[model samples]
Target chain A: MIARRIIVLLLLLGALAEAWPAAQTLVLVVRRDSPVTDLDSVTVRKLFLGVPVLINGTPLRPIRNRSEPHLDEIFLQQIVAMSQPSYDRQILNGVNRQGWLAPSEAASVTRVAAELNANPNAVSFMWERDVAHNPNLRVLRVLWSD
Target chain B: MVRLTHSLWVRMMSVVLIILAALAPLLYLGVSRIVEDGYQERFINSVRAYSRLVADQLEALDAAEFERRAGAVLDGVVLSGQVVFAQIVDGERKIHSSITPALGAASPREDYTFGQSPDQVYYISHQVRRPDHAVVLRLGFDEIPTSERIRATQRHVLLAIGGFVAVSIGLALWLSAVIARPMVLLQESAKRVASGDVHVQLQSHSSIREVAELNLHLERMRQELVGTNEQLTREIAEREASEHKRLTLERRLLHRERIVALGTLAGGVAHEINNIITPILLYAQMALDELPASSDLRADLQRVVESAHRARNLVWRILTFSRQSDTQAPSTVFALRAPVEDALALLRAIVPTNIEVVFRCEAEGVQLTGDPNFVQQVVFNLCTNAHQAMRRDGGRITVTLAAEEDPGEPQLRPGRYGVLEVSDTGEGIDPAALPHIFEPFFTTREVGEGTGLGLSVVHGIVESMGGLITVRSASKLGTTFRVYLPVAVALSNAAGAA
Candidate 1:
């Protein structure tokens, strides 16, 4: 009975590990009414990295989490194809060239979702699991696969 | 009482102190004012920059994010212990602050304002605009630090002013010494000069030109005084030597005058005595011829012999009067009338017949303490001068003798005097020559006609017998010589009886 119970516990632990999201999996989202339904990898990278992007004659505004290490790593590695420091440098360079703020930063996922709901041209990144509860937001692009 | 205000040092120091006293407060106020202005400008600018920075940060944030990070933002902006307080206020009366909530409850209504509390804290409030609220950033600065800075600057200014005043006083004292030293030395030298130190020499090496010139003038005056003193000494010595020589010459001249008087009297006496002696000898021979060798008529002839002897005795007395004695004879009480009569008798023999010789003895029995020969000689000399003076024009010669009591004569003391006055109505002595008439060899007569010793010898004889002789003469007027002899009081009664 002990041997059978140990085998069952190992199977349950493997299933729970399989259900969690990968460390680099981040989903780009926008308001449900936004004209930008989907974006190419280059367009998504340019929009989030402080470069101006337009879809269907409407400009896109970028949003970010203020202090989420996992999302920042995923976005820098999968979309920008640069290290975190290099990606930050690219964002600062784009801000200097464009003569505007790079992006609006939110303190948490709820704040990021609310920012996106309020602005139809706004864009942000979050965990795939958290996007299910935000009904006013839509997934624009997936940054990395599990 | 001497006043301190009159002192040069006091006056100089007072002026310096008054100027310094007025300047010190002004210097402190000026320095403090400049420092306060500088500190106030810097504080206002710093406060303005801090307020603008906070307003820009707030404008960029949403209401929810701003609410979440407002405390952290104020904490980041407000330096510990430097910014005394800081605050932010929302429209619904929700206030956030680094300080206590009660302290930051009211936002300043104005756009910008400054306030200071009694506790020496300074507050600068700035209004900021926001999307959902109005924010106020009230920053407090403790005034103690700024005040301390201003006070430090004032202290430095006071120290600088104090040093300047001290230096000015030292310079004034040095200048006063430089000026007063030479003046004090000059005053001392002048005092010595006033005290008759004519040999004082002043140094002419003063740095000031006027002082040096004054010293030069003082030295010149000293030299003049020395020269004048030396000249006066030389003149006094020369005058004394000249006076001694004059007195010696006067004594020698007096001796020569005596010899001249004796010589002049000897010739006249010899002629008169010879005339008397010839008659006596003739009478003796005549008597001898008229008498027999041994007759009774010889007794009558004896009377002629006695008369001849009396005539010879008179001749011997006339010869004795002409001689000068080496030693002074002792005085005796003698009747002044006798001397006057004897002098007249001698004068009658030689005086010309045209010149009347009158003798009046009004002093009846007045006696004098003097040599009889000297008295007679005085009368004879005066009569001889009178006779010679009148012989040319044949005028009258009057000899009068009188007794005087307390005669107020300038040359004679107040006493009873036997006064003998001889007057001649002849050519008078010149007014210019009157003062020297009694001097030996001082004569107005021709060389052979008269010897100058006549009046001088008369003056000498009268003075030696304790008498005074005075003469009064004028040009073309008659001359009178008056002799005053002191009366002999002891012999006056005896002589009066005789």
Candidate 2:
């Protein structure tokens, strides 16, 4: 009876966790003059992680969402295939080396995407629908699938 | 014996009261300003903290919750009779809630855009931030009652000032009286002293040291003044007595000199009278014994009577000189040369054969106003002295008659005076003997040869008639004697008073 009660408690905990709202990815967005067309998963990862962030022989940067920490976690896990433990270690190492960037909110990320699409040397990210009106930034599909 | 009050004390007290009254308002203002400054410091600190606490709570809650919480917080704050109002606003100046009952449910957001009221009102606004929105929390307090309280404070201040002024005035009045009382006494004492009461003095032991010292000094002055007054009185009495003694001595000396002169005159007159009487008696007996039975023996008897009458006239002249007994009224005017002529006639026989006499008289020229006897005496004495001086040398005498005008060095002014000068060319008086000639008993001749009262008697007669006599002589030059007699005042007023 105790085992049954433990199983039921675990089930209830999972159900409560699943009941939480899902957080969306924080995409990298840029202007149409951006040189990126076929990007590698590592390069996209490097850009989001603020490493080797040059695009089309010019420097680019990433934008982020500040809605929830879970959103950042989910984007790093699903898109960058980073586990929680490894991500914390990477963040700690980057902080120790003084090489980290803070995340931005959803409205700011879209604003960055619009500003970046008009410039050849800029890079930022947003949801796909958010960049639909901007003709400068082409979708740079990575070879890896989640 | 009088009681007195001092005036300085009253004056000093009044000065002190006036000084205190003048300073009252300034002192009150200074003290009240300090108290209000302290209150303002404490109030500012409490308001700052209160604004911060409310701002934090407002930022943490939603709009509805903020209104409820702010209302409750304002209700919870307890003020000690002071009014307070509180409100909350967003950064856009939108009012969320207000604790002021007078403001009602109205939103005065635009009114508070500048945050502070312009009517010298005191309010505190603190900004608070949340994840979603920023808000402003505000608190205010009314200053009308504070101003009224400040005004109310004046009542106490006025009471304090009044108390100080009253006390100061009272003290001043008391002090002035204390000082002025003795001074008033001193003034009265001074007045008494001026009126010749030197014995008055001020009492001692005044409230002020200076006043006490002054009183002591005044007492000393009084003692000194009394002593001085006594000394002056004694000196004045002694002086008056001494003056009286001197006057008596002068009178006695004058009387003895007159008696001696009278004795000399009496002997001369008695000898002449005896000689004249003897002759008269001898002539009368002869006429009676040798009368022709029917002859005119009447003529012989008449001659004897005439000789007797001449002797009596001479006796009268001597008596007049000796006694100065004539008291008849003075003549209005007479010729200056008449008395000299009469004196020359009296001495005609005594004048030597070699001496020639001359007389000059005008009808009314040299006029004088004096007893004829006194004038004659003055002339006779001088003529006799001149005749005796000339008899020794058989010299010539000149008698001049003129109105004296600029008579000599010490001249009398031009006026009517009869001047008779009997000048002798022989035996002029020495310079040394001239001054003493007018002094009684002073003579150049041997004591038996002359009676020295002649010039002195001349001086007396001339002075009694309000005239002056002067003599100038030298060893070889005959002496000149000028006599000055004043003209009468020449008005009827003088005769009226006389």
lDDT at position A7, candidate 2: 100
Q: For residues A1-146, what per-residue lDDT tens digits would candidate 2 score against the true structure?
A: 99999999999999999997553323454555556654443455565555646554666655554334544543543334344445455556665686665333354544665556555555555555545656656655311111
How much is B174 displaced in model 2, in angstroms?
2.2
Per-model tally of clashing residue pairs: 0, 26
lDDT of 1 by residue, A1-146 (tens): 99999999999999999997454446788888888876755566577777778777777898876547655644544455444545566778877876756878898998998888889999888877788898888886555443
Error of 2 at B418 (Å): 63
Candidate 2 regions exceeding 4 Å error are A1-146, B1-22, B56-68, B78-83, B91-99, B102-121, B241-498
Per-residue CA lDDT of model 1 for B1-498, tens digit only, reads: 267577665677777778878987787778777877766555544554455456556656687787777777776665544555566645455545545334434543221212334555545444344554445455555556766877787788778878887897898778766766787687788888789887777773679888888888888888888899889989899898778767755754675465457545753665576677777767876877877889777666676767766665544433333344334578788888887788789889998998999888786878888688778878888888888887878989899989887776655677678899999998888888776776555688878765465666576677666677778886676899888998896764555465
For model 2, the DockQ equals 0.01
TM-score of 2: 0.35
In model 1, the runs with Cα more than 4 Å from the true position are: A1-146, B1-4, B57-65, B92-119, B131-133, B217-498
Candidate 1: TM-score?
0.39
Evaluate residue B140 in candidate 1 and report its C-alpha lDDT on the 0 to 100 scale.
51
Q: After superposition, how far is residue B463 of candidate 1 from its true place, in Å?
A: 25
